[model samples]
Target chain A: MDTLLSGQLLFAALVSGSLYALIALGLNLVYGTLRLLNIAHGDLVMIGAYTAFWLFTLLSIPPVVSFFVAAALCALLGWAVYEGMFRRLLANPGLAKRVEANSLILFYGISVILQNLTALAFTSSSRGYQYLDTVITWQGVSMTGNRLLSLGVAGGICIAALLFLRFHLFGWELRAVIQRREAAQIVGVNLNRVQPIIICAGFAIAGIAGVLVSMTEQITPFMGFPFTIIAFVVIIIGGLGNIGAGVLAGLSLGLIETYGVALTSPGYRSILIYGLFVAVLLIRPEGIFTKAVRS
Target chain B: MKALDIIFGLALAIGGLLVPLSGDAYLMGLVFQLAMWIALAQSWSMLSSTTGYLSLGHAVFYGIGAYVCVLLTGVVPFGVALAAGAAASAVFAGLIGLPVLRVQGPYFVILTYGLAELVRNVVMRIESALGSFGRMIFMVPSFEVLVWCMVALGILATLGAAAVRHSALGAGLAAIRENEVAAETVGVPVARLKLLAFVASATIPGAVGGLALLRTGYFEPAQAFDPVISFTIVTMALVGGTETVRGPVLGALGFTLLSEALWSSLPQLYMIVLGLTLIAFILFVPRGLSGLADRALGRG
Candidate 1:
């Protein structure tokens, strides 16, 4: 009945969907390459938000620029984590075969560590910044400037990532490593050399996703787990290791979540997200993009 | 050597039960938590380590037991309520496990977690059963009664774990863990056995969680269904050792004492310490304390 309301919801969904897609993409990358779930992806995102928050509040840097700053920081931190934690775990003959289960537990510990440290450094209180908080309205459609900016950054990054994966030489290696580990190895794709870089990039992307969300949202120490859950839902829906489906599913889920909340109370939103997630998981663990999903 | 191991394990277990006789509520409470945690970790170990499927959302059954008994206590005899609650949890797990267990590894993990969160959210909406920060009081028989119940539950948990570890059913679980397809090819009833294990695993945690609620005399969805509880149970089991009853028992008790120390001194830092400990355990001591004990005994 209300076109304006529907339009507003649609826009909001696109923004959220794009953000979720970025997160799913990042998680998918790690899962795809290493055959490990980085449950710490959410914590990395939280840290990115903190990085952006501190950059703006402490040093008076513009929030937009802090996007790259946060990304770079996470990449560095991710590489260190990869070297320190994952490399050792992957090296173990017992754990390497059970990487999926082992990595999940390993990252859970890392998640706990990061969440507690964030609480210690920032305290548990939620923090927000005045970064593009201004609202813009046009012909009955309205959103905060920060929301729009985050959407733009998210879209830009997703597209750039796609293009990079399409054109870059590393893309071929990434695809091979993720899709054809054995063949890739025979073809001289050095998993030892390539995986750490991929993990590092994945961490950076997750940080970028975190910073993007923090722009229009409040930051909290405990926000990591929820975001991690969302990432799980998105990637699962899109099919793990399938970037295209993740993007589409991410956008769709974001829309559904935004519009569902708009239609019902906010409390029921989680129920909707979780219900859909379970349904998809039980029905099709391979994901909606069943055709060549792993590829 | 085997005889010595059994005697050592029994001594430690019996020693643990004797602690509550001291009549210190502080120490008793810690013991109670340790018992509940042991049961939970063992339940998790049953489905996870033996079956090789990491269940990320075990709190669903645990919370079900909490809610079901709380709701049924007055309508039925307290004993009946507790038993019914656990049975209901098993039935529920069996039902969900049918479809969800089809997905393995990360998918299974995510689905289980989602199921728990979903159930908790729905449970919170029941205004009659729980208010915001829901509080309820059922007459706890006695501190000793509570302790004895935990002891009994611990005994039951150990027996169940031992059965799974040593029985032919346990071999099926190991087969599934090694390779489900191969196990199925070898005529292991993968689905049926998994469901059976999933159902059996759900029962004890339900009982443990329900008992914990009755003892607390207060309940809230947030606290009762806390994801952290599942995480804590899993960590305790992992540190003690996975797939063995004694492993979770020792790990749960050891971590409980360690937490009591850390929580009193620095509540904020304790989680970080636990987290770091988990990482360290995964990196250097994957078999946990029980594994270390086994190695020492083997050397000796």
Candidate 2:
């Protein structure tokens, strides 16, 4: 039990939780605005991680610069996915359910495509970044420079996003669109312009998460599945339409999962997270935090 | 028309039996695998299409049945073990369905997937207790008997789908799929219908998986609980048109053959191909191959 409070374990859990929160924020953003469950959210993370990896390894770019580039690329991809696929599907509400189903198939296909392409291009060897002297310890509480930096960055990004939503012209318009698409259109919100930006912003956030995760762990083609499921659990646990709930759920899950692994085995950690999700769904079908209807 | 349908079913059964006699082991193996997949796909369709509960954990039921069959092989005759396996799977489905079916839509899908992962992890942890992972084996039945059993089960499952699709219970399920609140208001027992669909769907996969283990004489947790199995079976059901009887069968056969051919050659792009196939079908041919057939026959 004393091992539970070990600085290493606590630090690791915090780091993991921070990363989870980052990923969940992206999922929450997309679901919040679109009311679409994107199973491919994890794959987007994977794409971001791969993008960072390539930029760092091949182009000899620094990790920090690569992260932003990867994020920007993912934002573009997200916008393209919406413009190409989701737009057509949204026109017919009856076909919406089938389109969602098709998205899973398509994204899963994209995952396979990315994984295989990566495997073909750069053989299936596990790759990790060269860690510099980046460890920081204070009074026996140790944390990695990369992790702490990422946490700070995630915090800054989330805060900025909140402010943007509350104050920016497009952000308010986007919120209006989310609240009532028909009403927003009637009230002169240009949905055609707003939807693309929201999706791109969401993907950019997901890409940032991907880059952060890659820094802590090695990148693999199939790493998307576990992360994807984790993000899903987080968004589901946090209300679907609430960003704060997503952050809260993600951090809580990360802490629980980390402690679960510390107490039992890492193998049982995912089971516990899943069990928690099932329990949450059974107890509160609408999620933990309900979004207030905004005027 | 009903007589013609019955005759077509009988002719297919006779054709299945005659295949093994031709001494083509490769073809026999393919046919056997196809039959098993058809059973699985049909059962999965029963739960997902009929009840509108997209379960990503049907493989969990299949794995349970396989594991039970493996465990009971030492205590009972192989046939008895298979029965026990199927029963265990059905019972397990009923138990899991009680809590899980309360949720709807994506929640249900995610929960079922989690359930499958939970089962897999549990199996992995207890591997030493059960015997080492992939180390345990069950004795196989005679090839002739195995073939006949599989064919019988396949035919029964097909008929079961047809029956369920046309029954009063089927109408209730359809209503639930179309609109849950309305169905509940209209006196349809939503939870009970879902449970029944889940249990019934579970039975075929359980039996099929048990029989597959019997035929293969081996069991592995990862192999038994593979997401690929879940995805493939679901894809077949959806591709064939979810709510139809003939859809899953045709979907399973075509998907299996397509996968066997493509995966063997382009293992890398196979999943991508499958994903593209699913996306294309959903977008353009949302009704699936069965829907296509219905249109060709001017029944749509």
Best by lDDT: 1
True contacts kept of each: 0.83, 0.47
Query: Which parts of model 2 have CA positions greater than 4 angstroms off?
Result: A97-102, A179-181, A291-295, B1-11, B128-131, B298-300
| Chain A TM-score compared with the true chain A, each model in order | 0.95, 0.89
Q: Write the per-residue lDDT of candidate 2 for residues A1-295, one digit (tens) a residue.
A: 8779787777777677777877887877776666657777887887788877777778878668877887899899888888877787666666676544555555655566666766666666777775443778887877778888777777677667778878998778877776677898999988777767777888888888888777778888777878888887887788666777777787788788888888887667756877777777777767876654444
Candidate 2 per-residue lDDT over residues B1-300, each given as its tens digit: 345446766777788878778767777777787788778887887778887778777888889888888888878998898888889999998887888888877677777877888787778678845558684564566776787788778887887888888998899899998899999998999889988998999998888888888788888888887877887887888788874687888788777788778777877666666777776776678788888877776778
Span of ten consecutive residues with least summed lDDT in model 1 chain A? A286-295
DockQ of 2: 0.54
Which digits, one per residue and each the tens of the lDDT, describe model 1 over residues B154-199? Answer: 7778778888889998999999998999999999999999998899
Task: Give the fraction of native contacts in model 1.
Answer: 0.83
| Interface RMSD of the candidates, in order | 1.1, 2.1
In angstroms, how far off is B118's CA in candidate 2? 1.8
Q: Worst 10-residue stretch by lDDT in candidate 2 chain B?
A: B1-10
